[model samples]
Target: MADISFAGQVAIVTGAGNGLGRDYALELARRGAKVVVNDLGGSGSGVGASATAAAAVVDEIRAAGGEAVANTSSVASREGGASVVNSALEAWGRVDILISNAGFLRNGRFEDLTDEQIDPILDVHLKAAFYVGQPAYRAMRANGYGRMLFTGSASAMFGHAWQTNYAAGKGAMLGLSNVIALEGSAYGIQSNVLLPTANSRLAAEMDQGFMEIPAFAQALQNADFSTSDGRVVPEFNTPLALYLVSKDCTATHGVYSSNSGRYARVRICAAEGWVAPRGATPPSIEDIASHFDQISELGDFSEPMTVYDEFTAVAKAARKQGVYP
Candidate 1:
């Protein structure tokens, strides 16, 4: 296959100061994108800020003959998100790509999760994707072309104890991206989510050593599981993210996971559940309970991509089961 390039494309990457975001910004710049490296230069806990973090990345990009500008706006507020995008608009006049990757950890168990922990995370990781993407999306819609990507996490899709706040924030981005993919489709734009596990500060500090908590540890160990920390390397996670954010990406509304060298789609599907008979009285709790196994079985399921697809699946099932007759 020929090399994929972002030549002449104007892109924005949030939290580009370090870790996976830095890797993404540098690589995108290297591949010929005019990048806006947006970083508040905050700590892993999201408690402080500096301009040097973003400036340094921009410097590296320029040193390597790539184009980049620094933006130190936080991604937790609408104004902050727009300011970051404004840097791109101010420099290049258009935005062709967006990678919503800005975030910091605020870990806590469900019981301990507080408004203080929850609000900022939701603001940064979830709402901010919309804050930035909405403006960039409008630009793409006018230009009639765009590619948007979200930096999601495995912790949300799967589970890690003491990380409800972090997980909730990351999980919501997938929902946001899915809607963007649908809405952007008619405008020649695409959106996707990336659940990447890399050896970054966030990954290392995940769950606050929750794995050592024996009950959770024993339950998470699957019988078929055979893996090591080899997958935590960040370099291995960048390729898929880059591909999905490039112009050549034809796929949209996809949730993909990349750890080490393993790359795969993470799917959400509905089982072929029991359907109530036509004209039958509303099923009672006892009746529903009796069919619990059938309702939960994944022997046959549909991965609906849109709201319409859900109805289509139901119609198809009705026809197959002779319910329409």
Candidate 2:
């Protein structure tokens, strides 16, 4: 196989001061990408900021004979998000790759969570994608090439206590990436989501008891989320993330997971649910209860790419029962 390269490509990695984002920036720079390492230099809880973290990473890249610049811009705000992209543009003239990896954890019981915990999570994880992504998308559309990767989490798919705010933000990345894939198809742009589980300060701070429930516990046991020393380090996830945002990759509208050493595609499939009768009167509660098994069954399923595709699947199922022409 030919080696992958990002020569002449300009990349932006948010939260590159530490953890997974740091790994991403370093690797992209090694592969010949001119990277803008954007990090707010705040704590894991999104408290304060500094330019030191980003600057240090930039220095590392330059020391290694790679090109990179530091941009300490908060992605949680509209202006800050645009500034992130602008840094890449001003330095290298265009954005060919974007890794939306900036975020922090604010955990609490759903009912006990306050606006402080919830609002910032939304701003950084969900709204930041829109703010930073819009400008990057425009640049990619104009240049006729781009690769976008949205950082997501397994907590969003599987339940995690005290992470309602975090999960809510991570889960929305799938929808955002999917739409971008569809819209950017004609322009040679690919967008994808990465659900990564790695050991970092954020991981260390998580309450181990949060996964005490049988279901969550079982998920942890089933996945070998550890390295030789029993630590799932960030390097385990960097390879997959790098590929997804590389010019060689052709995947789009895809959600993939990198947990421990495991890599897999995370799909959202619609079941061939039971269709009620097409008569004048609608089905009653008793009718629904009777067909509950079939409705919940996953023996047959389809992965719909868009709303129209999902509706078409339902229409097909209805037609099979002679409920539609």
Candidate 3:
């Protein structure tokens, strides 16, 4: 296979000052993209800000003969999100790629999650996709080429305790990316979600409290997860993310996980469940209880692209079972 290149592409990476975002920005720049490194430089919990982190990344990129510019805009707000995109347009004239990776974690039990914890996370991880994506999407539509990567999380897909807010925010990325993929298809654009686990400040934050559960912690320990200068690091996620946002990517509306050097696709599939008989009366609670095991069976399944697709799958299954005869 030939080398994948981003030659002449203009890219925007949010939270590019550190962790996975920083790795993405640097690698994209190295691969010939003119990158906008936007970071509010806030702490792991989303408090405070500084411009230095972003500037330093930009400096590193330039020093390595790659092109980059720094933008210190908070992506959690409408104006701020647009400002990040505008910086790219103002500097490079177009945006061909976007990596919506800006986020922070506020860990808490579901019942104990606060307004302070919930609101900012949703603003940053979920709403920021809309704020930055719309404008960049428009540009890509006009240009007839674009790629988008939204950062999701394993916590949302699988399960994690004391991270309801974080999971909610990340889980929304799957829906957001899926719709964008369908909408952008006609315009030569594609969107995908990345559920990545790497050793970074973000992982460090998770270790502080989120990883305390023995089963969860033991699983990770057995996975041989390491930190700081270890093999399982942020740069491991960079390649997959860059690929998803590259012109060579043929997939859209896809969810993929990259964890500790393991890469795999994640899916949301529905089982071919029990269908009610064609009659005026709905099935009773007792009837449902009896057929619950059949309804829960996963041996036969369909991955639906939309709600209509889901219904279509059920219709076919019903026909096969003589319910639609």
Clash pairs, candidate 2, are none
Candidate 1 accuracy as TM-score? 0.94
Q: If scored against the real structure, what TM-score would every candidate get?
A: 0.94, 0.94, 0.94
Which 10 consecutive residues of model 2 have the lowest summed lDDT?
A: 223-232
Report the lDDT tens digits of candidate 2 across residue range 1-325. Answer: 9999999999999999999999999999998999999999999888889999999999999999999999998998889989999998998899999999999998877888899999999999999999999999999999999999999998897768779999999999999999999999989899999998787878655767667567767877896534535447889899999999997889999999997777899999999898888867889999999999999999778889988999989988898868877
Model 3 pairs in collision: none
* Per-candidate total of colliding backbone pairs: 1, 0, 0
Stretches off by above 4 angstroms in model 1 are: 207-215, 219-230
> Residue 85, candidate 2: how far off, in angstroms?
0.7
Q: For residues 188-218, write the lDDT of model 1, one tens digit per residue.
A: 9999999987776765556546776788777
Estimate candidate 2's alpha-carbon lDDT, on a 0 to 1 scale.
Answer: 0.91
lDDT of each: 0.88, 0.91, 0.91
Candidate 3 lDDT by residue in tens digits, 1-325: 9999999999999999998899999999999999999999999989999999999999999999999999999999899988999999999999999999999988876787789989999999999999999999999999999999999998999988788889999999999999999999999999999998876676545535647678977776786335434546798888899999998889899999987777899999999989988877899999899999999999789999987999899889999889887
